[model samples]
Target: MRFPSKKTWILLGLSIVVILISVSPLLKDGFPKNHDSELYMVWLSEFDEGIRDGQFLPRWVPNVWVGYGSPLFNFNQPLFFYLAEMFHLIGFSLVLSVKLTLILATCLAYLFMFVLSKQFFGRHAALLASSIYIMMPYHIGLMYERGAFSEYLAMAFAPLLFFVFYRLGQKISYKYFFWGSITVALLLLSHNISTLFYIPAVFLMVVLFSKKILNII
Candidate 1:
């Protein structure tokens, strides 16, 4: 493996600092009290319990819907909860795990957006694009106000999906194709609604870059 240049490290450090600053409120005492914050916490708890009880892909969450047990995971996105659960398994509190999930997602959003933009627009523009993406009002609201964990996670993966497809367009390789499939699958697991919105955009990307794709096949 090759080490990144000093410039790359600097850009990465700056991006991390910006992302941390944007989400610093999450590190303070008590939860941020967003619309769906408590709801996600409950879901993460139940999901963890379900996993402990031997349910790998838990669809039915008991103790919800007035104890009737809603099929929440079956219909809703499960990626964010799964990520948070990994943090919980390592001994973090559920609240901290949730917060960590949000922070990790923001970091990923910055990293992927930076890489994707850098491919076409050079490092400086990539840094600007990623900073704007991380600090955008709606993106900030997703974590601190709306608590839309799944959607926020999906947003992080969206640029990754695009980057993968862009690479596949540039060079048709099994590695890129495999990762592209995984990215799409992750996006679907992250947020079905957002996946729906992004599907057409991905298709358009494929269309725009079809010549190379066609040549490789």
Candidate 2:
């Protein structure tokens, strides 16, 4: 007979709590709510412009006016744009389109964090780690705000990246290596700043835990 692990039960409980928090924001008529009115207005205007010019990437948006005169691109990733474009084509509200993507990304992040954390630590550690991640200050700060979707999505990728690395080290497979590299690249693409922040911390953790770190030249 199969029995659910304590970790599984903890995750199930946390999942319910997170769902409630996420749905609470949707009790209103639209995305961003009145609390983040300016944030939504900015993204909505950019969505209109992107549709007018027919670009999948948010190129030189006037309202998201931070990257002007700099070679540095919009911190936002193309995946969100791609997802939003498809929703726009389907006649969904721009606000709803972005919200939907954000919600999915957020949920995936939680799920991945649990799975990944469990790979290294047991179920108890995994559930606790995942709970911390979902309640992270950065996520809470930027989750509903506009133009920060890339960071939010990339946040989820970080756990998956670690999980893949942990599995690769366990099995020592070339295919895992390839997939791990791809995950890292995607993280960089989504949010270079986050990659920058995560890379050092991840590297330090890896060095401390990975015996192979000393085996490599």
Candidate 3:
């Protein structure tokens, strides 16, 4: 196999550093915690039974007051629960489950941002942007203290959705459009409020860079 070039090695190294910084706080037990983390744990515990029975009970519940009735539960959409089901099947506790989802989302987002930046900006800019994003104070605060798992996951997918669209517009194809639409749908489902705003930002970027977009495959 061909070895990675120096630039590739450098970016990989930076990405590891960024991921460590992004996730370091969660490893500590001293930080303030989110109350919802407890509730989510209760919900996640039920997911495995749902999966085993071939039906999620929460879906069948009439009231679903735990979260569905509240603004927070419906703040965006129901995608987070669906995403969490995977961990539920694996028997992760609520706190671990939420953190796992957020950490995975954060990692994916950083990686995608790096790819997007490299595609649009350049390797150096991509590395810098990803580092800054992973190291951002708000993200750390939210993941550790606020326990904004849905927002974290949604935000992670946001960059990838844009990256796919950026590539899509360059060359129209069924796969690109379909996947782009799926990502948009997932984004909407995960957090509609964010998606409501995200969609426009993407549109403007495409409109503003119509020429350059055409050059990328």
Query: Number of backbone collisions per candidate, in order?
Result: 0, 0, 1
- Estimate, for each residue in 1-217, the C-alpha lDDT of model 3 and write its tens digit: 9998998887788788879778876666543467456655555555444556776434432224754543333243666777777775577655665666777888888987888888868778888988887678776655666666667778888888888877776766789789899999889877777888898988877765666554653
Models ranked on lDDT: 1, 3, 2
Candidates arranged by TM-score, highest first: 1, 3, 2
How far is 178's C-alpha from truth in model 2 (Å)? 2.0
Q: Would you estimate the TM-scores of all the predictions?
A: 0.92, 0.73, 0.80
As for lDDT, the candidate ahead, 2 or 3, is: 3
Decoy 1 TM-score against native: 0.92
Model 2 local distance difference test score:
0.69
**Which candidate should be chosen as best, given lDDT against the real structure?**
1
In order, the Cα lDDT scores of the candidates are 0.91, 0.69, 0.71
lDDT of 2 by residue, 12-94 (tens): 88786875575467546765543444554465556557667975555566644554532113654455556665676678777
